[model samples]
Target: MDHDLALIVGLVLIILSIPSIIAAFSDGHAPRVAAFTIIAGGALLVWAISSKPGGYTISDVPDTFVRVVARYLP
Candidate 1:
């Protein structure tokens, strides 16, 4: 996958895991999926950052998003 797409997907996975993590604490139960998501997301994010030519930063996200979207648009 492209660096931008990988980074975006990783961010989304991390964001999604937040809700699962919160529920685990509030409900006194933990889901294995939450743990997996955290690990996978972090790894993917790190890989994407390292794979990028200049190492992605938060500031690069918007431009990355636009560029990727433009590529897929008809």
Candidate 2:
């Protein structure tokens, strides 16, 4: 559960960073911040998924997401 939460957060961060990365590249500006964010998020996500004895599968994501949302939002 902890790993799932961290993975989800990292994924969301990586997803959110996409727009910033694209904007920086499109505007010919430095993408340092966005790039760093993407890298960090990716690392955390990888670490979280790998930390457990058995890594998660694609099918686990949706349930994890819903569980996290329910836990946090409710």
Candidate 3:
């Protein structure tokens, strides 16, 4: 449950950061902060998902976890 929540929140942050990053790029403001945020959030989400509880074993290479993580951002 905790892992799921962390993954969800981190992905949300990454998704939210994209528009701000694009806006910064178009407006000639350095997007360094937004880029950093995206990287950090992505890392956190990956870590959280990878650290899921011991009961379940992941069988599929591209499962719902990957879909949920990648869908909104890309």
Candidate 4:
């Protein structure tokens, strides 16, 4: 997968898992799925960072997302 795509998916997965994790904890249940999602997201993030010549910075993230979205959608 493209590094940009990996980055986006990883971020989305991690973000989406937050509510699941919170709900699981509130219910006194193990956050098994959310934990897995986080792990997968982390792995993808690592891969994207390592594969890219220069790793992403906080400021570059929004631009990267916009570029990727524009590329894929248009």
Best by lDDT: 4
Q: After best superposition, candidate 3 residue 2: deviation in angstroms? A: 1.9
Q: What tens-digit string does per-residue lDDT give for candidate 4 at 1-74?
A: 99988999999999999999999999999999999999999999999999999998989899989988998895
The number of residue pairs in model 4 that clash at the backbone is 0
Whole-model lDDT per candidate: 0.87, 0.88, 0.72, 0.95
Q: Which RMSD values do the candidates have, in order?
A: 1.6, 1.4, 6.6, 0.8
Please estimate how well model 1 matches the true structure, expressed as its whole-model Cα lDDT: 0.87
Query: Per-residue lDDT of 1-74 in model 3, one digit per residue for the tens?
Result: 45655666676789899999999989999999898889888887777767876523346323646765676566
Which rank order by lDDT, best down to worst?
4, 2, 1, 3
Report RMSD for candidate 2: 1.4
Once fitted onto the true fold, the runs of candidate 2 whose alpha carbons sit more than 4 angstroms away are none
Ranking by TM-score: 4, 2, 1, 3
Best by TM-score: 4
Give the per-residue lDDT of model 2 (tens digit) for 1-74: 48878889889989999999899999999999998998988987899888967898989889989988898995
Q: Candidate 3: misplaced stretches above 4 Å?
A: 53-74
Residue 17 miss distance in model 3 (angstroms): 0.5
Which parts of model 1 have CA positions greater than 4 angstroms off?
none
Tell me how far the alpha carbon of residue 44 in candidate 4 is from the true structure, in angstroms, after superposition. Answer: 0.5
